[model samples]
Target: MYKVPKLNNQGTEGLEYLYIDSNGNIETSKDHSKLINDPDGVLGNTLKPLLKLPTSMPKDFGFITYNDQPPPDDKGVTPSVNSKFGHSKGLVMMDKTTGVWLLHSVPKFPFKRDNNFYPTSGAAKAQTFICVTFKYAEFQKIGQHLLDIAAFPFESHFPADFHDQLKKAAIIKWNNREPGEKIQDLESDAGTQFKSIAKKLYKGKMSACWLESEDLT
Candidate 1:
């Protein structure tokens, strides 16, 4: 005979089963406490060594590495653009107190058609880059109360101007609008006020780093 056990946590309940094999007979039972107590140990010991395996590069060389080599004369291929939109390039600031996810657009390559082209060899294409700076204390607070912060809505806490600029960027990036179409809709003072506020808030207490679209997506 086999018995099943119920897992209870506060008001939540779940059923789990265990198995036993003797001679040619096999029996299933519910005994999940060991699984809960030492799950990592059991899973880790059962899995084969993953770290020992060597990573292989992708066969699509052009996609992986974008050398300085010029694009072929194929009509489908397009040249890279050299325009920058903002000064804070790829800034992402998360507020622990308010649970806000703020991203800043810094100046970098201008929007252009066929921005996805890459070199056939060498380093990967620089898709997008952004830098962010945040106070150490704020970061610490975020770390200490991450769960609480995560529950907050991002748009409500951010500055109105910053939100507006981000919304514009989102529209352009997400809507697949043409460069000309997006340019016509740019605000006269897109990031000026937001930058001033960010500088005041972050000041010397922040660390700046860049994250590409790949990282964010």
Candidate 2:
């Protein structure tokens, strides 16, 4: 996935997605342990993979991926903008110590649970992503922000005793009313401080703010 187009390597700018294992080693190839697969569903042949973690992963590890468009293999369609759902796409993976959140603008991506595949449609257009790593406690605030935005998480795994807000955010749900704006103060592992502003989607009114520099003392 890190390969660059030879012709446009000079000016092309894009984000690369990589999988890091428990030992802090980057996985260059497909790791079966990280794949989500379910051949059977609640009824039969549903192919809905549970959001549980692989046996090889630590029990505390958890992840959640959501998108406005469901995976094609699921036989689902995207909701209209008029609907209450949030037009957002992203994934959040975390453990007890720290975690990362990846926000992107790709449709029908991350492919099916059966494999690691990217959609041609997504590649045909320009896409952007922002990834950040944060301390575990910040995820609760992140979860609250997701809830406010009415995020639709398609797959996730939050262990027992996990934060209530995170578990709630990791599933499909609607907000009772327009949620209020929120501000979060975060500190990354590198000791960088950040302030973020988030609000729900209402009448196409969506806004976000963050500090992109490390010059703050």
Candidate 3:
């Protein structure tokens, strides 16, 4: 499994869950109930401001990522924008109506919402993540053309337009695609292949490193 790198805030380590109470006061607690469970703290304080960019899209977007696999298997390695944590991977989704881009990550916090102390063994993965947004159409073009990463687990896809020529091409491609059984055979190692391909993609102009800070707004 991937180990999310810890971050520091005002000298506090791994304090990303702190939230603001009413009256705009920063609040936290040692008992753990005070820990944040929603996305607002970061969104309201840090993100909303950067989203000032004008967008004609409906302002809708979301994220997609594969669930973690049980250990003792070759789980995939992802390159994180946070170099301190190395790299992480996830899917990117959009609402065509909205121009917002959501970075994806698996949310398996170390603590349960109700428990103040560590719980029993074999709980969810203790991973770290940052909640942020970006402008849509940031990437020049995206498609299955050579594993263009829209998300993991290979979710549903549809034709972006209803043009006759596009439809014909899609139908031909669909019929020519691998059979379902073939896809299942590859599923076991798909993530590993995805990671390898993503690395090679960075050599071209289609990729970005978190180190470079690809800002949309």
Best of the candidates, lDDT = 2
Put down candidate 1 lDDT per residue, 86-144, tens digits, no spaces: 12222123322221112212122111112222122212211222222343223333222
Candidate closer to the true structure by TM-score (higher is better), 2 or 3: 2
Instruction: Evaluate residue 144 in candidate 2 and report its C-alpha lDDT on the 0 to 100 scale.
Output: 80
> Higher TM-score: candidate 1 or 2?
2
* Best prediction by TM-score: 2
Better of 2 and 3 by lDDT: 2
TM-score of each: 0.18, 0.63, 0.31
- Candidate 2 clash total? 0
lDDT of 2: 0.60
Q: What tens digits encode model 3's per-residue C-alpha lDDT throughout 87-106?
A: 33333334443222223243
Clash number by candidate, in order: 13, 0, 11
How much does candidate 2 score in TM-score?
0.63
Task: Tell me how candidate 3 scores on lDDT.
Answer: 0.28
